[model samples]
Target: MEGVVSVNPNHVCKLHTTRSWDFLNLTLKDVGSPQESDVIIGLLDTGIWPEHPSFNDTGLGPPPSKWKGACTGQNFTCNNKIIGARYYNSDNSSDISDIQSPRDSIGHGTHTASTSGGVEVAGASYFGLAEGIARGGVPKSRIAVYKVCWAFGCSYADILKAFDDAIADGVDIISVSLGSPWPSDYFDDPIAIGSFHAMKNGILTSNSAGNSGPNPVTVSNFAPWSLTVAASSIDRKFVARMELGDGQILAGTVINAFDLNGTSYPLIWGGDGANYTIGSSPDIARYCLNGAMSTDKVAGKIVFCEAGLDGSGVLAANGVGTIMSDALIVNPDYSFSWPLPATLISPEDGKTVLDYIRSTESPTATIFFSNAWKDVMAPKVVSFSSRGPSAISPDILKPDITAPGVDILAGWSPLAPSTVYQDDTRSTLYNIISGTSMSCPHASGAAAFVKAAHPNWSPAAIKSALMTTAHVLDPSKHEDLEFSYGSGQINPLAARDPGLVFDASETDYINFLCKQGYNTSTLRLVTGDNSTCNNIKPGRGWDLNYPSFSLYVKDGEKISAIFTRTVTNVGAANSSYTVTFDMPPLISVTVEPPVLVFSYVGESNTFTVNVTGPVISQWPITSGSIKWMDGTHVVRTPLVVYNYLPGAPYNLDSEQAYTMTRESLGLTHSNVYHKTGMGQSRAHPQFL
Candidate 1:
């Protein structure tokens, strides 16, 4: 009992699973150094494909002297680059098809592991698409794979055990691309519990924000101890072009690898093949649900179907391809990849396709292979990346930052199919996928990048560097503001040399836990020490020395809160930083000291931010920033004030929140995710 930490009933968590380093202007030449090779990144996911070129240790030195991990599973080999390998299935519920070894059978683990600290593989891609040199943000960093997920979903028992092992294994950082379906108490969540220990051990844990998004209060992995990452676009976008016989061209956001060899195929509306005799409705056929379409009619035709539908019927009926018309989340729908040649177009374009199909006696169409298009309006938080005002801790922001997560081409396991569909026998060594899972590893790599440059920095210090030096995002592009992308998209180059950091220690976090309402007994279970709440009232997160400031206010109540923060100078000695702020006209914010002058590096400075505003009735949330600028560096901290109205139409209480699904969230891209609970093609669950 004395040795045991907190215990919880087993709960299942699902797996979640990048791109453009050039978009961040991070070239290989300026990226890694000998110090980077000393850092080790531990990944808790499905597993890894060590045989892949991404794990090659060619010309690399042996593991560091502090390395204390080993290869603990069969059928897996670890090199200097991947110094550790272990697997867990404490639930004993893996499918018979699943291999118990650390070798990845689901591509999610391999993809994420490579995205975090993979060696550069030249000319890597998925079927020649997204072709480029595949490398991680910290390519020289070592990777330690801890297989915690499986076909039956990741059990909390295994997840916790993994954390126990990884933290003791001398890992510098932990990357987890998995989460539970819903928010739970900090003590009840395995990630929150695991990461608390990781933080105490001077290891930063990077986790996914989840795929449930375009919806408020859906962020997962929201604990303050972990770095929750959101998915965002890079400069590249994939589009599948459709050419109609009438000389009209329609482009849809998708990843279609199959080529028709420039030949056109007959096109037909999915509704035309409805099995009316079997009580199948036109809507059912139009959506292309299985058993609704007649095979004879749709075979060899490119079926036109409504978007957000499984469209599995088309494949089942031997249809060559599909054209999906998506009406929701327009301005180019979420990009997805299916086994067959397919494309997802806007509803308006779909109307044109339907018209051509109905008017032409013998309609014809062609879907070209997906091509990469440059998107100028990128770095936008993706629609699937979870939104925040954390369901667990609303006052403290979740999704600490954003990273390149969409359409990331990374290492893959040949044991798994290229597509999520099991029917497709295609296999590849590199695949493109999207999720906060991908983004978490990117953040992990960035954290390692910073750790390499500042080896003495703590986990909180590394997180502060990443958050303060991030690239600012446009509020106009995101509806939820900071809730959508956290501080901003990551800037690995700038993060390495952040002028200052807001570092917190184990004692500070214990105090924060007390403020969050953890009693003495519960605190001891978590901290493994006799820590007391000391009569601290449960309240907003104003005391934690976080890099960002966020206040949650009631809808009608006056917005008045004071935040006291401390910054540690890690830049040039004898430098001074003058404070500047940009806030809305309705809000008044002031800092006690106008400037901070540090006579030497590692010197600490304290400041207090006082904000007062009239009741904000028209706006749900308003944001500003506090910048401490010197001639050489600018340290930025985002400020967010949200009027969170209880029992609002969209807000859900803990008792009522469990029932809310992506379906309830209204037309979230249901087909895109690749959960451990694998779906039958375009029907994956939201957790992964």
Candidate 2:
């Protein structure tokens, strides 16, 4: 515990495990451990500290042996017997021989590696992902670490180099935790396009869903070939900090506020005549008031003010507390504390507690610094996670999954220049970090598990395992949290046990390209500049018919199904599952099912959906529906509905379901039948 920061001891139990409750109590031994020779997972983040105790005895130590030159010939030997690492910082001017190839200036790589595939050295957890003390999800797997994130915001250029290098090295699995918030065309995005190539080459890749929370997924790192991970608070518990009287105390067990979608900001007030009644509405009083600004309003009192307000630096400028922004922070929590407060809550609580202070007596009412912080529990998705729809294939599903992100605790480098806030403080060890920068490794770790279990599976198969087997429930609520937490939380154990899979291949993507109307030869020339399109060939043009496409049409209107997935049962190839598509009249939908038949264990299928009405132009007055049928049972596809309305262009209204039965699909069933869509939309644009 030399450099270990101790989060409040009360919350220690929560930190004992990284996975959500649903994924608890599972291990590598429980899941099948296939041959690992074919699985070389890659980590693209801050460089790793191979010298860390975790890989000491495993021979996966620091650079030179672990680190190799960026050149394909020098870096990837295709040996499969060792961990491969490379560094690519544009600012540095050194060759593989001039400087160390695997030296990590930042510790992020080390921590991420420990989480994904560490080799259980001493001082590591006995049962967790990573080799040292902890056992990573894929304990038997090897790794290929690449340093892409630099001291400055990781340049898009460095990331591209890393991607090309990873591919040239022929890594079987690639994981990238770095991303951006701004939107970009999927194909236009170099990283995304590169991931596509990696997948085509039979390399499974995973990226972070980003850490920008409470924001729509309009900004995400999307690649049809990658699994995009989103962060969720495990069990909704985290550490917190409480400042009382003049003494500050490290606190524990704060309230779980990760689900505060509509929660308001806190307001603060201070000094003489500061007496104020606690309002009945806790929602409206989320600000902190303090300093000289409180003189006119509550002279001598402290008024904690909101951070972001219109034309005002403090509450005095606005005069009205409620008119200001959300909760006020007494001071920014720049450096992360041990189990840092799960999130930063309203500063009003601190001001409220301080208001009750008496020179000669202990403050009677201790403002409950309850664990209500959310940022602490879940780090923000970085602004740089590549986003969708694919510029080249806008219709295809990209970024198949989401994982943990936010200020993740990872290895640090005292030698490296400051990257995050804590790094500037000269802290060589623990650092607080956020962004998709922390999410990508999660999927990579998962891919390692998949590769270990299904050595013969293709990149699409691995992605299918993660997505098809993903648990879409919020770890905090133990229920579904869609859009925000795609495919739910990362359940590596479940991903390993995917009963059936919907596998795709390079041919499938080529077919997808052909459907988009791109000539195969022309596409080959454009993507690879060759007559022969390798498995890693980039698609020639955009695909407007991916299953994950969004449809905005007038209410009660019908849409066409231009795309659908073909699923096969590796465990039970002969087992047949009914395939039916249903929709509400408000939003009529159809699919080409004959193309979706699963004739054999590894068979594939395809189809699409086409919206018939204008997008965001004509508003419908009603809602629409979408559903699916599987033989004797009928189930509804989650989160697919919309409707247009008068005066409004397009409104994502509530979902209305229409009945579809096994008999309708030429099958028989005796069970009671009823199905409803969970994500109900309304006729309000703001509701979206």
Candidate 3:
């Protein structure tokens, strides 16, 4: 928490507008109930923008009786909806850009807070795009802003202070959209420690699976007590088209608010107008770096810059427009509106554009903005969303689930620049941003929605409910793996009544920490208890009573891991479930006590799963599932078997290779295999 961390501005009340509500059979009417109004979500981030329309409390009453926090900072006041506001800056480092107040200047905390519990705002849009009645998952829920992040980054000291206060203030759910760049030990991780306390206090914590993704072992929030959320795409996407002078139109992705009025502009390559002041090479100038382009040459002409170039820099040089290429092929479905009209094309299309520019004496193109599109191939996991094989606890899946994170339109701060540039003066009440940061709030809102429905359920029970009832599907129709999506896309309504929940108590997590090698001193620091690991035997990581099953097997090693889990019946009392399982190749799974009979609600049943697998060469991770099927419900848990060698051949350069690794061990694509410098074959996987 106390690192050079950036905010996760990753949504829209587009919650109900998108397939999220319909997919889960949830309605705005259901979310606006009185029970939901009692739920308070503690947002730990930059802060909040109290005046935003989404935070309006016209219909809300006074703060819940359990609230104990207060509004801090000059002129900061909380309404019925935004019941509490507090700021923490223990590092005491004064960054010029950060305002020393509870009011949000970065826009991330405001956006996420509103996304989790904002009221409905009619005609909500980001500069007239994605216009709809924007609201959070549980619109009546209250918000308590805990300012822990600043311009420099979130500090570990500040995060802990906020967590302590927020829990004492009686927040039912904690939504943390901040994370470190890499995995760390639970004792050293601020988020892990803070969430542990929240879990102990019965507050569910939903966290972002860091944006450093599409890579293995990049997940930052791997704590079993927290709901680690991944980002995915919704059906709606924004697209821009480039109409060339030759009557051929090339389709690219961008949010273009500027209109050219059908007039075409002369397109010039950045290399042709290279400025020597910043760099000597015209090739480097093609990247459109600051001072790399000649103002006189690029002025009044559209410039085509390479992938790494900052489009805003070209605009600052008086360039009329930009045709930018992707640095990497991310979610082609998602795009952002720059300060000027720009189109982001894939590298393949970029090559074609370059060829056309070189072939013609004069090249001109017109960029046309398209209305929002609903794609058939949506709900695909965005390439930027972090993947898992949790680096901290390999036995547990990191991202508990994915949510709509790509091109999300949510409430924004009036103080923050719309284009994310310091010089840009444009501002809006709502903005579209993407990241796992955005996905965290969506899951947080959903968790709040479930919490409102079942107020007595424990945090672990709620997390288990979301994971068990989640929809399992990969980006492609084929090759669904838990490493990328965990249990899968969340289904909030289904989660409210997840027939059975893998409930864990504060003691269970303490046991997990004990097994993680935390000594008595470290355990005391984390739990604030005089607890010793003396009585607790070191438990297996796979036996943490989590909703999903994960096992790590090294290459050529035959190992068997047994996981003990307990499930509590939350559904009908007279229920009987038969355990059914699917095994991955090379791994055999068996559930002891194959059938469970429950006589009443809250009846608990314990089961043991024995998994035996041989590490298959070239295959890193493979997945299957175990389901408890009664006549009324099918409680399913994804079973992930990872053959993780310190260094493995499964790492490939393309996304296709990763997909192939999950689907089958055979590699039919030649691009996956590369000759190494040591004259040996290697699989060069793409890292974010």
**lDDT per residue as tens, model 3, 612-664:** 86645555567789999897777999887766734322323343444445335
Candidate No. with top TM-score:
1
Error of 1 at 352 (Å): 1.3
CA displacement after TM-score superposition, residue 198 of candidate 3 (Å):
0.8
Question: What lDDT does candidate 2 reach at residue 338?
Answer: 15
TM-score of each: 0.94, 0.62, 0.89
Local error of candidate 1 at residue 323 (angstroms): 1.5
Clashes in each model (backbone N, CA, C under 3 Å)? 1, 105, 5
Model 2 lDDT per residue over 1-688, tens place: 5432111111000000133211333454553354543456777765665555444434332322323334222322322323566666565544221224555555556666655665443443211111123444555566677766543435565666677787777677787665643333443355665676787677876766543333223334655556666553332233444334545443433221122222222223322223245331212222332222323443222223232221122333233222111232233222122111122334554334434343415321112223323444232222223232222333343345556553344444445322212212333333334344455666677778767777778776666666655554433432222344444455676666564565666666655555544454544522443333344434322232222333333445554333344454554445444444433344545555522344566664444444343333343222222333334222222223233222221111111111121124321112110000001111100001
Ten consecutive residues with minimal summed lDDT in candidate 3?
675-684
Model 2 worst lDDT run, 10 consecutive residues:
8-17
Candidate 3: what lDDT? 0.75
- The lDDT ranking, best first, is 1, 3, 2
Where model 1 places Cα greater than 4 Å from the true spot, the runs are: 275-281, 308-311, 327-333, 535-537, 648-687
* Residue-by-residue lDDT tens digits, candidate 1, 1-688: 6667676778898776535777777788877688999999999988899889999999889999988988977777888988998998877777754888888887888888888898899999788798879998888999998988887789898888899899988999999999987777777788888899899899999999987776777788988878999999888889999999888999988888889987899999988989787898788788887788888888999989875444467888899999987555356434667778988887889999999998999999999999998878898988778788786577687779999888788898887767645556678999887778888999998999988988889999999999999999999999888999999999999998899999999888888888877788777767766678887877667989989988887757788999999999999989999999999888899997989999999999999999999876545778999999998888988999887634332323343454444445452344333211123233222225
Give the least accurate 10-residue stretch of model 1, judged by summed lDDT.
Answer: 674-683
Model 2's TM-score against the true structure: 0.62
lDDT of 2: 0.42
